[model samples]
Target: MRSTFYTEDHEAYRASVAEFLRREVEPHHGEWEAAHGIPAEVWTSAAAAGLMGLAVPEEYGGGGEPDYRYRFVVAEEIARTNTTSFGVGLGLQDDIVIPYLLDLATDEQKQRWLPAMAAGELIGAIAMTEPGTGSDLQGIRTTAVRDGDDWVLSGAKTFISSGMHAGLVIVVARTDAEAGSRGFTLFVVEQSDAGFTRGRQLEKVGLDAQDTAELFFDGVRLTADRILGQEGMAMRYLMERLPRERLSIAAAAVAASEAAVRWTLEYVHSRTAFGQPIGDFQNTRFVLAELETECDIARAYVEKAALALNLGELTAVEASKAKWWTSELQVRATSRCLQLFGGFGYMLEYPIARAFRDARVQTIYGGTTEIMKEIIGREQAARYARR
Candidate 1:
């Protein structure tokens, strides 16, 4: 199906992104996976190619475009290559952290941070999940107490993407112990901070090149200027921006599903069994037909959600629907596609194997599928209550 979601400019951007990935990312992906992370040089290369910050203002050394499609083009091209490592970096920069700074940061904060981030000199990470809390924002135990001219932070975060390499970490900590959700605040914890420490890079079933690790803040001190939003407003800040984060996940899911289906189609056509190509079998044909249809449906819905997000019209419930549905589709699509690859699909060298491993985490992160359903269900119940 033809997509009406992108303009010629978007297509042009996609071409450039594709070329860059083929030249810079694809060749070193195996080396990165072995190293458990990509080098800082790759990030700098991406920045030099204008792949780092599509929505950040040009004055900050970014692309200066607020259009979401430009970001989507990067996501789709990265997904098509089965490159999960770059997905988190791009997603974190474009979808998660950039918006927080752009929308809430003081002019001084923006000026201090945006330029380095755009140049990829500074890598950013959001430390939200703690040893105890995953999606429960109010359950975080990290605390930041006011101390004269500085705030003392003490807490630990686990499963933080880019944790090891992050030059700037936006740590979510409790500022008002008596106020529950309203008490939370975001602090920019620099890597050079005395008490800040990082645990070893975690071994994971997938996304091996993206460093996920544990972060420790044992009375790490921060000045007042490092606070991200207004003190005691971190929860609201996170809530307002989650829709875009979820939509970004949805976009990647759809793109990955399409990639899986395409790869499977090619494999079935070229591989033979019983003296005939597997693609000639009725079972393979039917499976491919079903997958193609599902992929198209998912692509259209995600593109629509992305458009809505670009227009500032995406609601929480809609974003939840997109996130859960597309991620579930990705899991199913990748699993079935792997089965079509027979025994070879299980081999680590094949892209399908890596994609299968990577797809498992998508449903678990970005708010698990169950959590997304709960959000949607609660909204529906509230609507009926009003009725």
Candidate 2:
């Protein structure tokens, strides 16, 4: 069944995204993967193609569109090309970082940052996870001490996506020792800040073109203007924005799974065994049938969730459900699809090999499957208790 989730405008945007990828990303993505970083030019090219900053207002030099389906179209197109490294990098910008600034930055701050970010001249990242911290924001050890006219920050962040290229980073730090949850604050740290330095880019098994690195702040100083939102409101801000972030992941998962099935379907129809095409085999037919059904179901759920997010009705519980379920589905879909390709799937030349590797991290990042389950479980228990 055809999904009515996207409008003609969204489909039109999807066509432009596909053309942009074919012209700019497809030819050079493998080179980027080998280099462990995408060139700065690609960012500018994407911005020129109007692929960046769909949610930023027009005053900031963006498309001024906030519809989540536009972003979903971009994800779907990128997944089709199997250039997920590029998708992951851009996801950090649009899904994670830009939303923070749009929601939290003061008007002056927006004027200062949004224009450049929308232009792809200033890449942004959020520094929340530490070497020891993953999923627990309260456990962040980065500290920011108040001075007469400055805040002295000292901390290290690990696994920061776009760390190598981000011109600005939102650093989460503990500002008070006794306030517990209210103790944390967010600081906008610039790359040019004195005493701020980037550690080596960390390597990973997937999304190799996207740079993840360790960041170090040794008494980096910031003025009051650098604060994002109110002091001690960082936790609240993070919680509020998570629905969009997780839903972004969920949408991408659905797209990637669908693409994997498409690729596997193409491969099975052409590759033959036992004097017939593999797709003609009963086992292959059954596997593709199962994958397609699941992909369809996941797509429906994600489309509904996207609508909920647009309407501000998506709860953290629902977002967590979408995030965990579709991510796990992506892993399953890619793995099973890869199996259908036989030995070719294991080769780097095949897109399935890359998809398999890239799918592994979907269930890990944006909060783990375990954490998502816990959130849902706790919500369920709370409802039962209320009853």
Candidate 3:
């Protein structure tokens, strides 16, 4: 479906992003997959192309625009090429890390960090998922105790994206033993800090080019200035910003489904079965028709959600609906598309194989599908109670 969500400026930006990916990223993706990480030079090049930070203030050497459509366009163009690894870096920078800095940082903190982040000289990661806690924010075991002039932190986190390459990590830890969610706080932990160590780069079923790892913080000391926002308000902060994160994931999921449908259509048309093109079969045509309609519906919903998110009006319940529904569609669409490819679908050389593997995590991360349904159900119950 042709979308009216983007304007001419967004279209121009999309063209530039497409060119950059085709020229700079496509050639190196194979090597990056083999290496299990993208090189620092790619980040530098992305910074040079003004692709690193779209919403950051120009004073910090960024685009200074808060329009999310531009970010969505970049994500769509990347998805069109079957590039998932690059999306992780862009999504982390634009969706996850930038908000924490923009919403919580003090003037001095912004000055110290924003420029490097904009320039891609500094990579950022949010350390929240621990060995024991995945989605339970209140169950975090990491602790930060106040000293005279510093805070001592001790904990371990696993499944941290960009952990191995991140120059700055936003560490979430408990500040009060009995306060539950109110006791949590965020701290900026630099890579150079003593006692801060990164564990092995994790190998996963997919997204081979993106770095995911374990992080260790043992007696890591941070000065008072390193704290982000008001202390002991991490849960509040996270709740306020999670809508955009969920919206971003939903946007990417819809884009992936669209790409999968397009790829399958092309494959079916070219490959013959029983001396006839597979596309001539009624089953293939019906499957493509259904997938196409679903993808169009998903894109429309995600586009509306993106606009709501940009206006600061998207709610947790709405985001949860989008996240769960679109991710489930992506998983289903990728699997069906791969099935259309027959034996070739099982080979790693096929993009369908990679997309199938990658789609499995969409429902699991950014809040599980079951978790989303619970949130939506609770909100409905509250509304009924008010009536």
Candidate 4:
């Protein structure tokens, strides 16, 4: 189906993104992957190309475009280039980290952080997953005890994306143990803080260029001004912002799946076996047909959700469905596509090989598939009970 999700403006933006990838990202992505890190210049280059902060307001040095289609274009272009590590790093900044500051930070806080973030001069990470906690935000062990005019923070966070180079980290810490969910509060922890430390860069199975690390806060003292939004409302904030994050992941999943199918289709049509193109085989045709159909369906749903998100009508339940379904589809799409490539698929030099590896993490992060299903199930049960 021809979708009306994007306009001429979006296509124009897409061209720019494609050009940006060709000029700035593609040339250096392999080296970054090998080094397990992206350099600061890439971020600034993205910012210079007006790709860094589309949602950020123009007054603060951003493009001031809140429309989600622009972001989708960026994701699609990045997926086409197969520079997913750079894409993930950028997504963390735009989707997860900047949104928090944009929505929750005070004017003072925004002034201090937003401009640099918009310029891509400063990187940010949100540290929510603890050593003991995965999906349960309530289970975080990080604590922040209030002193006269300061708060003493102590805890550890793991699996933090952009952890190694983030100059500013939004750390979720427990401030009032008795308040349960409300007890958790968000604090901005800067790299210059006395006791803030970053552990060794975590080696991951995929997203090699995107840095992940363990962060430690030992007796780190924060002034009252460091609190993000209202104290003891971190849970509410996290819940509110998660749909965007999940949807971001979902959009990437669709783009990756689509790109995988495109690459595989091209390869099968050209690569010959038994005096015929591999695509001539009924089995190959069937597989590609199914993969394309699934990608289409996922894209339609994601488009609807993206439109809903722009209208601020996207719900957690809706985003969860998109996130889990499309992510799993991406994994399946890449795996099947890789299989079609035969022995060549396993070779790291092939884009499909890297796509296969990168797609595996889609189901694990943002939120697990199990957790997404549970959220949908619980919501359904509640609706049934009310009826």
List the candidates' TM-scores in order: 0.98, 0.99, 0.98, 0.99
State the lDDT at 151 in candidate 3.
96
TM-score of 3: 0.98
Show where candidate 4 strays beyond 4 Å: none
Tell me which residue pairs clash in candidate 1. Answer: none
lDDT of 4 by residue, 102-207 (tens): 9999999999999999999999999999889999888999999999999999999999999999999999999999999899999999999999999989999999
Task: Answer with 1 or 4, whichever has the higher lDDT.
Answer: 4
- In model 3, the clashing pairs are none
Q: Each prediction's Cα lDDT score?
A: 0.90, 0.94, 0.91, 0.95
Give per-residue CA lDDT, model 1, range 1-387, as digits (tens): 466888999898899999999999998898899889989998888998989977889999999988888888888898888788887788988899878899989999999999999998889999999999998889999999989999999999999989989999999999998997889999998899999999978999899999999999999989999999799999999889999999989989998988999999999999999999999999999999998999898878878888888789999999999999999998999999999999999998988899999999889888999999999999999999998
lDDT of 2 by residue, 160-239 (tens): 99998899999999999899999999999999999899999998989999999999999998999999999998899998
Worst 10 residues of 2 by lDDT: 1-10
Q: Which stretches of candidate 1 lie over 4 Å from their true place?
A: none
- Tell me the deviation in Å of residue 257 in model 2: 0.5
**Clash pairs detected, candidate 4:** none
lDDT of 3: 0.91
Q: 1 or 4, which is superior by TM-score?
A: 4
Per-residue CA lDDT of model 3 for 1-387, tens digit only, reads: 366788999889988999999999988887898999999989878988878888899999888989989888877887887779988788988899988999899999999999999988899999999999998878999999999989999999999999999999999999998887789999999999999999999999888899999999999999999899989999999888888888888988998999999989999999999999999999999999999999888888888888898888999999999999999999999999999999998888888888898888889877899989999999999999999
